[model samples]
Target chain A: MAVTMHDVAQRAGVSIKTVSNVVNGYPYIRAETRERVEQAIAHLGYRVNVSARNLRTQRTGMFTLAVPELSLPYFAELADSVIQAADENGWTVLIEQTGASREREAEVLSGRRRHLTDGLIFSPLALGPDDLPLFDVDFPLVVLGERVFGAPADHVTMNNVAAARAATAHLVALGRRRIAVVGAHEGEQVGSAALRTAGYRQALEEAGIPFDPALVGEAGLWHRSTGAETMGRLLDSGVEIDAVFALNDAMALGALHALHARRIDVPGEVALIGFDDIDDVRYSVPTLSSVDPGREQIARTAVELLVERITARGEPAPFRRVVPDSRIVGRESTGDVPAGAEGRVVGIQPGGVEPVEVVGR
Target chain B: MAVTMHDVAQRAGVSIKTVSNVVNGYPYIRAETRERVEQAIAHLGYRVNVSARNLRTQRTGMFTLAVPELSLPYFAELADSVIQAADENGWTVLIEQTGASREREAEVLSGRRRHLTDGLIFSPLALGPDDLPLFDVDFPLVVLGERVFGAPADHVTMNNVAAARAATAHLVALGRRRIAVVGAHEGEQVGSAALRTAGYRQALEEAGIPFDPALVGEAGLWHRSTGAETMGRLLDSGVEIDAVFALNDAMALGALHALHARRIDVPGEVALIGFDDIDDVRYSVPTLSSVDPGREQIARTAVELLVERITARGEPAPFRRVVPDSRIVGRESTGDVPAGAEGRVVGIQPGGVEPVEVVGR
Candidate 1:
């Protein structure tokens, strides 16, 4: 026989309403009464029917987090952070792997699976600023990444351009001339590739160095293999380079692998830096220099924004555009530093909203 | 006005039954009629109420994938593979990060969230064979990993013992007599730690080498930092070792980092091999040697088993246990190999059901 709230209430010697309140996590109930109700429920093996509660509340207590791919360390870490933040808010996360397909990204925004989730936290890779019309859906949505700027939804991003500039400027301070940049999406006018490349150019201009198109390596995907292939091509092309800046840590790691295979000493022959200070950077041989893009802040802010939109009772607030602060983190990949010593900040960028540091992991 | 099935049917010039057939993906509908119905659905902006449909069908078309953590490269790659496989079966996956907590793992098995998912694919860490009774739940469950063996549920695993022995024997064949094993759990009787340790001892016994307790480094968590700390402790303890066998690649990478910090030349002062041939192994400075544990096969098999259980209508089949084949993959971490040369199989284990190869990435 199935156990019911009535059975629990009878066993606990409480009213059915009291049992309901306890099950719903009402905080005002007496501690002794709540304990008795909880004990009765456990003794009776009473399980809450989440679907029934969701139907009554019109909220599934679940939200979707759509990402490009979890195999990528950056996205995997971002998803992990988002799941942790969402768990604190009493929500389960359903993951959707869009594989960076434009059609699939559009399907996610179309509310095709709206019946299964209260809202969505999307990190798009394929759908760009041109797809702003799709963001006008009747659902709580928080967009991540620089793909769709000025979309009709709350957005959480990082200081991509400034961070990239800091990374490039650091290499310039090291007296690196003929610097090469990996993971350039040819002719891209938006997204991380475009913004980071723009920052690279800005840093070069400030250093009185002319931007050389030959030093830009085109990589379709920001994967380790692509990074390695791009670096290998640049080396094979006989282009004299003193430093390399990979767009992400994965690509930078790949570039390191390529350089090692060619017997090119990192920091001695060609210094290197990567974006996204992922955990992998610390374990890389000559621990990688990278940019801390404030991934945890981005995730927490995105979840908070989506939660506000989902639980709003009256008129919706104006959409917000949030950009978390980012900073450079140097290691042996860029220049030799003492073990366990925090890398000295060679150049600091102003206008950051938060204090940042280059702590050695 | 909200568009309904009637409106879609009217616009498609078809009966409501035919429209429902098209929406439900019934295969018997004519191609032209299905196209017309889909076009009508798109034009009318009609969406399926998955929750109401779930109530009628008693199936949510969703499943839960519970892992210890997604930040770990092994679990992240496994989750990516599982999501791809589940998507092919037309199901969505809700992830539960147990954080290796016994209470949380037990709660998942207790059917607390059963109402939201049709089945579960759980990779438990804390709970073990002693908690076999917990697996006797009224849900379609498929377990992964070596934690809870012989539990009353479908299981998919790898050749832990044989694979570990192969890894250890490979190090021994490299003339490394005093090999130190990392990631050992003190006094563990089950799980990967114990099973892999058993294999290490077996290899030593076969080689007529005595097992020394001093060379075993204990790590509670199979994380990179833990691996590094364990290795640092082992090195600091004045233990003479020529080889290291880390239980996992993350740990092996960490151990490599520790070795580098001390200026120990890989394949010179020490040889190392790790389990789980993760993508990181290839990018590691020395290109770590590792065991390929057939992760993709395990994921596909687990998903297929759970799907079968969920869709079963008649008498249930006996629960099955699956152990995929594993092979050792060598790289520069063990010894120098020509670039792009397939890793030579120094010693081969005969029990692998499937033919395996040593391919260089």
Candidate 2:
């Protein structure tokens, strides 16, 4: 009832081996032969069960990178970096957007896409400490970002706590005594928001300044508009602050917008700093000062770790966490820094995770 | 000898059908049965060739959307739109970034990805007329953008030339002459750049203004930095212009940056307009006026056309082109307009492509 490879070979007047090669996507096959085989396959309505074939071959030559959303500047640029790294390793990346839902994040672990790729590179935003067990799945996975901790998989991340502290310290060094923090998640016990907030408080304590809860701005989303909205509230509240530290660059840009609307001068009246040195920061009106978390290095390390896991698939390998070196990329948004600030590593101390030999830029 | 599903079924101590369903990712399987089958699959090291299985089933329930880059807000937003469209139709999108390379675009068509999906939605950048015939392939393809012309496939595009004409004419009607156009390609005879330039010229002819070649700014890449770089050159060249019509939003924002650097009064000294009406334009200082090219409509049409092609895969379907209606969105950057400018449908006339019924928004 069904057409087979033998029928296709007979229809094309080619050998079974040639038909198999054509169906398998062997690039070196002659064009004429390939076309004839393709025609026969089409004529016969022959199908290639890719899943079955991949099971036999034991290699799909494809990997997947799942993130919250590609529209976000950080994630979009990170996806591009991941693609570059995947290309270097002779693999293609299948991207999936999880909308930052815990359920959806869990689905990605056991979803059909899991069976489609050789391995996965994930940056979870919604999954929590309770969902850590989901990381113990059969597939080779390498975690990314600061959302998940103690997962039984290789992790590639940056020093979020240290970086955030150094970012706050930069503002202190710029002679700003009253620094307001934007994008603080209320009651956040984990994730980047919590870690970065803790780091900010640590810097304040070290500088002999008391941490003021009223100065911490709340943002449900780290988007530019949210940043602007939160900053607007802070400004309207009559908060006495000479400087602002946004959790991310998008918010910093948004805060700049709010400041611009209010006729406030940047680095003249109030200085602003952000994390994640996205490309937009470089081109911003008064280029944004940000914590460069070594995104490229993280991308490269994630891909490489996934490759190693895929290679050593059956063996029991120790779970390792990698924290790439990070620094602040000072720009005009922060007043004139002393010369030779370029390539200046910000945080000298390590937080919880031991340094796996920081790959300095 | 190779292990088989029958062997996996025996080892898992389940019915062959249960093992088959588990391996095929049918969701109705019991957890105990699934775990047993997974263990058997792992012990046996089974590989499910995805291509072969997809061929046998004659449907992968997946499609791919290829664009130049996702980091570009236009493409990134466009990708988000396509993903939304695909999701509504019960399909997943595999995004491929070609970096606008002709070679990369070709590779997507003939590469392994072709075998992994049922259809493709392609927005080719670096490809040309010579490569049009390559669209005549075995699979279903719906082309997006105004890059390639006369391709014998379902084409979903916007009225680039007409939209550009209306944008330019809007500036002309505002009593602004010597309007410079940013993001012009040097020798492009096809694609959006050339068509948009032609539209700008038509508007100039109607306005009794001579087209100035010196006012055409050259940009190899339609990026903010490139836009800024080109605008900087134009300013340094001492080209006196009262307004600017950047080809896209990113370039418009870049031009805005360049103007801000020069401390030039926006709208008061020089009005600026752009196309694409991306989200950033709304938040831009002295917000941007842009041609709303119906990106959401374009995305919906492309995905729907792709579905139609994929559904009618065996038969020869007549090539169809869908051009959605577009209009200009006035904002702060273009300064004030006379009364009744808000609802103006910028491009009312149709070009060579017969207007398919516009799916009303």
Candidate 3:
């Protein structure tokens, strides 16, 4: 059976012109009228193929993206890339921060606001399976982040466990038997912290090394200060560790500051590694080694998925779980040096067993 | 003549209960219906004294705040303080980011979305006098930032000129005869850049120092990298500056980085100061001195003003222009120290003129 615009108009109790207006983004339509038309379109599974409709309607030349917080450097850099990508697409992006709150996340999902945007790339932090019912929202919504499970919307995220495992493996490869993990959530069953912790254990198990409970330092917030506090506490508790893995760059920076304050030589006394290859890591004191979580790919894919959903309304595509690969960035902090280096050599103590193969020069 | 609820209901063609729902934030009412009631209330100039109405509506328990971007630390900290202040008032804050776009700013001004929250504290970066007509929005809105002029909404901003002047005067007070300015916009007549530039000139005039055009560095963006680039360019151009006043902490950081790269000694050879007392200032190598722009006060006052208007219906209270005070924070980079504090001078050189009036340690 073929679905038609007339059927949608009848179901929505709106004129065909009103439906057209809603589709075309004519701003004068009342909010309620637009909401009704959108609901009808969704109910009827009506889609206007954008590639074809674009010739007739002309491109609005706009893209919409929503994230948790911009203040977080990772997200800020991600936004910078997204804007760059959107620029390449000849589109300008409108950004919204959801603050990772449930109510706000729900509001973003509701297609009621679709009239204000062409489509949305949403990165939700607080929404999960219990809120899956809200995925029926009428607009194109591409979800990002690891907080939600079985999300009805298309999603893009990083390979959290694999990446964490690889990061920990890198430390183990450096012959560091005692590695401390920062930014561990004490009791969370899900989320990035838990997955990363699992990956840490996997790496340790694979290496035939014992995972010490005391090596896991808990940081409630992933801020730099939290990282420093966690490190300080670990030191205060007389925990001896050769390397530290901070869950994120900010925490890693805090750890670096704490180590510096205590005059602990990086890559000699303690090797420091951080996740999230944030821009500042390139210029930090002993340039941090980190995992590039493919943030750029996530942003680009999220946008593409949202656009597809917006253009293919009736076609119910299966939810997507995109796991972009991660790579370890070797730097001074991880004792990576190229031939003919111009700086002083920070000697490491002998008798520390080296594991796996070292790739860095 | 006294305006009554009956008159408002008669004009709006809605039941008194509907009006009550609109006033009380009963979410079930359709957005359009709520708008009509609000319009009627505004047209009738009815004022709902919040303190008086608090007895009836026990839920003055939430407020909405909108800023341009949360990724910027300044706005992030501002939002944090605003949330804290609202919490102190027994209220939760709902935050939204406009990405500092004019269209989004206009959308916030239009009362179309007022039903979602009781009042709005809007920080506009893109809106200006040309958009003043939109300021006639019916709901309570308190505007934050220096971009918009003559807006009917209440405004909260820093004393940019005075603060910048004071910052410049501090450099002069330290016997820096040739001071440079970073983060200057080339030809802007308004905005923070222009205001701060004016203050710089005022300080030079008072100090009897000739303003050197070559000493002013223009940056494409206010980011740290841009500040560094601008500083590098100024140095390359052979401008002999004994001091620097960066417009913001970001630019100041860039300047610090640039100075470090050039092997220029801070405080001893060239003193440095910055605006916006951002948290990062405390962590910089030579710890930056900056002006505290009273952002927390601005956020709190903006919320208070919006709440006042929200409860007041459409009584048209006089627009408020809140100018938050700024104070100088003296730090290592400024070469100012407390009396009787003698320490081993490692990298710091002697014979630098000291500025006594700086407040920071």
Candidate 4:
């Protein structure tokens, strides 16, 4: 049987409140009393019942993270990083999938089940700035994603616009003109699709290259299938493109498949680049080049922000944006040369090529 | 502002306890009083706070599922199914990754964080039968995995021994004798590795084939890299094998990579099979053949068991084993058909394959 606080108090000849005070690090406790309680705790092996303590404090010491889907490797990796960060801070995380639906996203922020958790870290895909009022709850929330423009909460995200520009610039640096963009959502003014498209255009304009409408492929979702289908459509439409920029790794993989089916050699006939440096990219057939969007930093920042809000005891922290930098990871997919460039490999770009367009607001 | 129970009770001219009773559907409330409370609830738009009500009942309406990792697609998909099942029962799920550490597994069952959750659905890879006593705590728990034997709590898992036999038998049926087993844990006696290895031997004996020790490859971890490395080691050891069975999908993928490197024609020169029907298998080059261990059913059953325990109000429900069936999903990798037979998909095994070996001593 586990030892109770009462047992520890009895063993130390101190009041149960004194033990509690010591355990909670109450400043009023004398050093000798604290030392005695601590010694007794170690001797009796009295581990505090976090649940019982939570009842008194009305805090569960647990947080909830709601993402669109985990089947997507990106989110799966993100969740893994978040859990690791949360564990380091002595908190447990509950995971929920909103499936990128507005209703589900709203439900998560409603706080109807707030008692089950101390706070929430939400990544909404469908909910936008128009739904900002839904976040007006009494719980601490740290939002991730570009779907919601100005939600009232702490947000940790990548510089989507700048990152997209960097990816396009990398392809341009490889001397590939007429770069095609895959995974753009039609009629959308914000979100990842719009932001990445804006960045792509920004890079092309700076390079003095014409922005060709025929080079833009519309993808409803940034999924592999969508990317493949869009790439096929772009080709079928007779777009003259020597390079491709997929919004994410999944789409990039899909593009690779499409190009393979058409016997279009990557970086030979056309260069390819993707976003989100997913783990699989390293092991891909040609090892895809992608953008590393500081995922580790985002996870740590989100957890720390949520923790600050929880510890502040109702002092609402100002909504702050954590903009992490993104770097291009050059691999064979981008025609980057093999490490031992002894002329054995043909048509390979030199390693560490500079960006064609500089990053700026 | 959200409406509170107080508003409903005051409007209904009844005490808060009466409103609580009505909301909870407690027996013995007068019919007219219930009717009045219901009307007041609807009029005031008072949605019951699930978390607060759980607090009053000393239950959290939340269960925690601890797995080794989420970066693995199998666990991520399993978590998604579990969350879906829990949501259907008006419950929430919390996720924790123990990294297959015995110490962390012990902490989960320690009951120190009981207030954060009602029960736990744990999948332990490191701990075994010797640690069962550690699970004898106040809170409820359901164990998931083939690692532990004779656990006191309810067990939910795939029939690893039987499934492995069926997988090997499939290879035997294909006229392959000298089959290699990848991803075996050397010297394991009772975990999934040991059980699967025993099944492999049983299948070999039944086929009147000698069990070649050199044919078994040991992997430190059941990952794709390890699988690939083990396959390479097996080949380097000069083991002439006609077929290979990987313990899991990741290892199988690694094995595929190894075979490709060696220029072995799959199904023509050597047939390859893997366990765990990961989503990526369908799109993989040559596509992978694998076993579907009814993970969806296991997730649903675990969630159902936890929900029952939570609603039982301290009543101890009898523990039972949920042994879901497994079947082979044949793809191009198995060499079941000629190349370009993409559309000729086979159906799931009828009556589902039963476990070949039952441990009922």
Q: Which candidate has the highest DockQ of all?
A: 1
What is residue A257's positional error in candidate 4, in angstroms?
Answer: 3.9
Between candidates 1 and 4, the DockQ winner? 1
Off by over 4 Å in 3: A1-70, A76-140, A169-178, A202-210, A263-270, A282-287, A330-361, B1-70, B79-122, B126-139, B171-178, B205-209, B262-271, B335-361
Q: What's the distance in Å from true for residue A160, model 4?
A: 1.4
TM-score for every candidate vs. truth? Answer: 0.81, 0.79, 0.68, 0.74
Question: How accurate locally is residue B79 in candidate 3, as Cα lDDT from 0 to 100?
Answer: 74
Going through the candidates in order, what is chain B's TM-score?
0.80, 0.80, 0.75, 0.79
Q: Candidate 2 on A141-164: residue-level lDDT in tens?
A: 899988777777788887988899
Question: Using alpha carbons, what is the TM-score of model 3?
Answer: 0.68
**CAPRI quality of model 3:** incorrect
Query: What DockQ does candidate 3 have relative to the true complex?
Result: 0.07
> Candidate 2 on B1-361: residue-level lDDT in tens?
5676657777998755566578767787789889999999999987664555556366778888888888888898888899889988988787888878777788776534566677889999988777764565556788888877677678888888888999999899889998999999979898889988898999999999999998999898898889888887888899898999999988998888788777787778888999887766665666678988888988998888899877763334567788887778777677753321222344443433453321211
Top candidate (lDDT): 1
TM-score of 4: 0.74
Tens digits of per-residue lDDT, candidate 1, B41-109, equal 999999876655555366778788999888899998998899889888887777777878898799788
Model 3 chain B, TM? 0.75
Residue B114, model 4, lDDT: 57
Candidate 4, residue B31: lDDT: 93
